[model samples]
Target: MDIHEFLELPHRFRWGGVGGDDCMTFPASWALKCVGVDPAEDLRGTYRTREEAHAIVDNYGGELAFMDSHLAKIGAKRVQHPETGDIGLIKAMTGETAVDQIETQIGAIRFGPLWACIHPGGIRATPAEFVAVWRLTA
Candidate 1:
């Protein structure tokens, strides 16, 4: 699938859980298509509630640590500026569970100037400065 098609895949999922159609898996949809690797493949279906998700994040020592450790092993390189097809992370002001102002970041994909992630209704371009991003290679 091309970038346009890849970006559209998240609409098919109902957003919820740690790995089903949540933050990690949403952008992961693009990685799976572009490089034949699913970033959240291991975590999918492993947790279903907010607390369980927090435990998983803790297991990896924090959210960015988990993303950095995982994305690197799969051929993605962290970049200062993300282009289209790059995986980006940003701090989200979601609510109380945010840790040290990190990982509340929903992993998203760069689509020109906007970063795409799963929203309540569907996929939408969210406006938040990326704290970190990973460039994918084929």
Candidate 2:
């Protein structure tokens, strides 16, 4: 399935599933798996922290921003489609402090690296709202 279809599946935010940042890495890793790419191999050691994940994405050659640095450089308008293997940059909610608040003011979410299945919640949507979807492309 495509990115939107995969994202349509249910998702739950388990901060400590595959890793602490599983919320970010799990989906991205799953997305890669859907495309028949083994994230363990293709994305090995790419992310030790959220910032590292963003850095890997930034170096991947997209105009999109992984964190505030690139976001400031490219702006929100850079986000377009929600393709598999694409990254979704979302803003963290107020009073949310899971990881290092890179760009808390703007809040950011990324759904890429694709996965085999979707999470309990669609993308980064909570019980209330779903923010923007940014597709990571080459």
Candidate 3:
């Protein structure tokens, strides 16, 4: 599917099933699918909580490091600007406070201008001024 088609897809949040959409699953799935690549059957089930997800990145050093590692793993190249089909890595508050401190989440850029993310209600769009974009390479 093309970028336009991908954007037109209905957005929903599912923790472990890839039926329509989810934050962690959508960007990679859409990017891969756009190029005729079938993304993993299940990109869920491993990490179910914030702590578990954080641990996955912590194991690879930190957020940026984890992104770097994933880029290498997927053969994707980091780009300075947003393109139609590039995946965006973003940092935003998790809305929960820990010891009076706010936690942040790293999510993908499914689309831009108004970068979209999955939320409990549905897809949420945020400004792209602070997101990092990457282009997937075959």
Q: Model 1: per-residue lDDT, tens digit, 1-138?
A: 776887655464433334347776777767887898877778777777667767887899887897898788788998898888899887664533445334366678888888887755567786778989999988
Query: What lDDT tens digits, residue by residue, belong to model 2 across residues 16-100?
Result: 3343224444544543535443333445455555456445665854323333233233222335555334334443333245463
Model 2: runs farther than 4 Å from truth?
19-21, 38-85, 94-138
Please, what is the TM-score per model? 0.82, 0.35, 0.72
**Which lDDT values do the candidates have, in the order given?**
0.74, 0.40, 0.62
Give the RMSD in angstroms, all C-alphas superposed, for model 2. Answer: 8.6
The runs of at least 3 residues in candidate 3 whose Cα sits more than 4 Å from the true structure, single-residue gaps closed, are 16-22, 36-43, 96-103, 110-112
**Order the candidates by TM-score, highest first — what do you get?**
1, 3, 2
Evaluated at residue 8, the lDDT of candidate 2 is 61
Off-target runs (Cα >4 Å) in candidate 1 are 10-20, 95-103
Candidate structures ordered by lDDT, highest first: 1, 3, 2
Q: Candidate 3, after superposition: displacement of residue 83 in Å?
A: 1.5
- For every candidate in turn, the CA RMSD to the true structure comes to 3.8, 8.6, 3.5
**lDDT tens string, model 3, 1-138?**
676676667777665434555455667676567554533343456656556666766987876676666555666778887766677777654443445445455556646476766656676667644446778766
Indicate the worst ten consecutive residues by lDDT in candidate 2. 100-109
